[model samples]
Target: MKPKDIVLDFYKSDVLLDKKTVSELLHPEVTIDWNSSEGFIQMDYEDMMSLTDQMARAYIRSKIRISHILQEDNLVSLRFSHFVKTIENPREDMLLGNFFVIWEIKDEKLFKGFQMSHFS
Candidate 1:
């Protein structure tokens, strides 16, 4: 698949809560650099798999809405929101926050990503 298609597939998986698809689209040497209000994090493919596994359990019915998408060559960028239930008396889902991710696709898979998040 093209880089943009792969990136779209990534978001689609998140929206559908389909970790398997996400895993399959990730390159074996994938690396993700994440920056958020909490802090900055660097993770490899294995770490990503583990984190996704935990997130699947935490947000079994979560939804991710993509608001914008752009692509150039093998790079793709997207803006989105990840909705999740609140901690206190959790309901279906509320707007968790907004996030941006720029992915570099190599060999038709997600090879690297730089992402940031914010709440408003």
Candidate 2:
């Protein structure tokens, strides 16, 4: 898959439900630097997997709405919004956040990322 395709699929796929999907998408040495409404956090591959596990336990379903995506070389820039149905409120899908991220692909997996997001 193209670098952009890999990045898009990573977000669009059921990653929280399937650890194998995350394992396929993130490189072993992957790192992401994220700045959110709360604060800045840096995460490695294991951290990312842990996050997915947490989200899986908290949310019943989730979706990503991509607004824009651009790619150059191994770098991909994407803008999207996340919506989720929580386990406690499975009937309603709530807006989780809006995000803008730039990802670097290495060995056909997501190698590094710089992300910024705001909650709704």
Candidate 3:
């Protein structure tokens, strides 16, 4: 699948809470670098799911809207805004950011991924 399509699918799966689809799209050894004020947080597939599940439980709803998408070779850069409503807060919060994800595909499956995000 095209990089854009892959990204779209990932978002769709997230919206639907489809773990299977999310797992399919992600590499088993995927490295997620969450850029934060504290430091760069890295996670592998299992840790990612653990963190995701915790966040999912805390948030009532979350969605990502892509403003721009760029692809070159195996790299895909996505600029997007995310809207999230926490169950406790019950108020929507918006975060704008750009993410760069480098994907390695093998046999039509994503074998590895490295990602970093910058907030605006």
For candidate 1, write residues 1-120 as lDDT tens digits.
789988887776354345677678889999999998889999998888887777666664566788899999999999999887534536667777799999999999999999999975
- Estimated TM-score for each candidate: 0.86, 0.95, 0.73
* 2 Cα displacement, candidate 3 (Å): 1.3
| Model 3 per-residue lDDT tens digits across residues 1-120 | 776567666765245244566678777767665665446787778876776677677677767877777777666666666666767767756553555555555444455666666665
Q: Is candidate 1 or candidate 3 better by lDDT?
A: 1
Candidate 2 lDDT tens digits, 1-120: 899999988987356556789888899999999999999999999999899888888888988989999999999999998999988888998999999999999999999999999999
TM-score of 3: 0.73
Clashes of 3: 0
**lDDT score, candidate 2:** 0.91
Which 10 consecutive residues of model 3 have the lowest summed lDDT?
A: 11-20
